[model samples]
Target: MALDVQRNWDVCMAENLERVTKESDQPKDKKDARETTRAEKPKIWKSEPVYLPDEIIIQILEYVSRFHESQYTLASCCLLSRQWYSAAVPMLYASPYLYGKNFDPFQAVMIPSRNLHVRDSPLASLVKILDLRGLVHQASRRITARLLGRTKGNLEAFIAPQASFGTNSFAALAKCHQLRILDLSLVSESPPLFELLKTVSRLDNLTTFRLPRSSGFSTDVNPALITWPRRLENLALSGGIDAHFMHGIVALPSTLRSLTIEHCPSAKGFALMHMLRAAVRPLAHLETLKLANLPRLSGSACDNVLFILPGLTRLSISVDYITPALFDFDVSSHREAIECHYPTLPHAESLPTRHQWTDGKQCELRTLELTNSGNPGVEDKVSPIDIVIALDEGALPNLRQVRVDKTLLWQASATAADVDALADALKEAAVQRGEDESTSTGVWTF
Candidate 1:
């Protein structure tokens, strides 16, 4: 090594000496011109390579991951160098948005071989969200199960495809202990309710769970056999859950904070009321409730919901199932019936009467959302004036927001004055509560 270095140094000196000798042999004008040209040339400064700690690099990558178009940037970063590849590969695979064209490629990478021991990619373990809701004909049940098996180690959220998910997928799903959100609402052919609930019972970290719209709990689900995740906070129930199943759910987990029931074809008004009184009223931590699209519900089915769930802070109900009497106190048969059912209930006496209800104190409801269930004449069932009158009578004193659908014709000139009154009432309520004036507290139509 030393000899080779000495030889190269001698060769460089000889070349420099030859160049100098030639330059000295040149005319003074030529040498001066060469020197001036060299002086006019630009100089480049080389900077030292910067080194960042791994934690700082990871934080920056996380921020980039928040952008919707960050996947391309992250993919490019993976080829920079070993250090950059190590940092970017995980973020790139953490949450992949699979569409039709890319589904095959993604599956090939995740399941390189049918034999598990022969091929397994570390990238599968980096995935925290495996959303296959976009693919329809591109994947099959077996492939979906294999993909889940590959990602179950770290997967936190799974949105099943609309048609391909089946009983085979549940085995891998049960192993995903880190799952937080499971949305199977789009499944056309849902797996049996018994197997789904059994698999979900082991997910200790699950928080949000939505049942498929095709869920048919025909006979397998026993009320006493049902068990939910320990920390479940939000739940949605839909489809084929008839009066029998509705009444069978005697208890929901106490940790529940939000509950949504929609698109039930067989749920009658009386059965839902029974469930609310017997099962839902005992949940002390519940806050938000949404009910919509029940074809079997009567026009006056949900009028007594406010009386039954007095502790709810947010309620979204279809105007088809309610009337102006929804906000008006029914100290008659409805009130007596609720009291008759739960004689020891604490909020039984506080079911406000038209003459005695205090402003904002009688009702804890803060937001009311009105939706249409495609029923004719629903546009006139509940109006802006009706809500304004409710506010005037101090029915919902804490109500700050009222959202209506455009199908309700709330923006028509006939109801313009009433809408104005509703807005002013909301603003006044916000001000009385010492809330910001710029807060979105008024009526909104969609």
Candidate 2:
């Protein structure tokens, strides 16, 4: 019986071994089938690699180029493919405005060098404007010198303020033949600053220019070199500007439409009024004039100058003082001076004579803005009654819209009841004159 059992065991062991062998073979067969399928499939042409269309890649490059200092990353993209390199190279050198603190030394060297490569690239002709500010001091002067040497003709607008370079740097900038708009503000260094201005004046194409504070030009300096551009439309001068600068500005081509004078502390007493009258008399097409932070001139000085600008549609004057003479037909010495100086103005016509100037004339003044911070003992000491009288007589006659800050009216001590009374008076006057009272708009609040 033991022998029979042994034989049965042997037979079962053989059957189990055969079953394991079949299971192993089954796995091998499946593996071979997969291998055959992979081998039989046509090989994809991946060795050469399919790439995005050139136009799409170019678009991505253009998008990245819009960033100020994207040149490094964009240039690195060139290594991806010849097509990518070609697409990114031009945009890398496009109009770049360099400002703020992040601008480092490496970027300065790289930007101009990259620009050199870009100038040689298909996109070299595309760059137009270059704005270099505070961060330029970090760059090697050599890099700036090189850039100024290379792309001088293509640069249309150049803005560099408070840059640490010397007059030599500006001399390099002057070489740019196509320079049109130049803003050199906050540059305190006199040698480089003057040299830069001198160079700018020589550029026949220079149309728009901004000087740093009022100290840009010497008081005794002749402004004949600072001629107005036929294309020049906007001029902004700070209070530090000397009377000679004003003379230069007034002598500019009549094409000027906007003039902004701020913080002219040097223009104290009657000189401010004299400067305004002289500066504005020739600007026939003058549309907008802004004067702010002027401590020397009073509200009366503003009115005296404004009436001379008949074509003026928008006027903004922020002064510390307000007076009834500002709006009233007061024949004081100041009024007499205005009449004697500017005979064409309406204020001069009714001098000591209360003739209605607005009787036949269409109201040309569209907007009037008066703003003052009613700081105790700091701003104007005029009463609200004086301000109201000024508005009633001076403002209501020609202004279509008036914007008076609460601080200014409060300084004048005008109450809500006073405002209502003034509005009613304006309406009554407009009705009597057959004019539209609805056209009058006033904002008492800030």
Tens digits of per-residue lDDT for model 2, 1-446? 99999999999999999998877778787978988999999977668677899889888877777776676788699788888877876665566545555455424444444546563422434456666665545654555555555557687876654545355566657777687776655554534334555666566677676655534566555666554445667666663665556545446557777777765666554555566667665777777777776666554555555444555677776645444444544335355555756477674445642233222333356666666633345344444445447556554465545566666544354366665665565566567778877756443446
Error of 1 at 319 (Å): 1.1
Write down the TM-score for model 1. Answer: 0.83
TM-score of each: 0.83, 0.60
lDDT of each: 0.87, 0.60
Q: Candidate 2: deviation at residue 59, Å?
A: 7.8
Off by over 4 Å in 1: 1-59, 339-361
Instruction: Give candidate 1's error at residue 435 in angstroms.
Output: 2.6
> Which portions of model 2 show Cα errors greater than 4 Å?
1-93, 97-102, 105-127, 134-147, 191-197, 214-216, 224-226, 244-250, 295-300, 321-334, 340-363, 367-446
Please give the RMSD to the true structure for each candidate, in Å.
10.1, 10.8
Candidate No. with top lDDT: 1
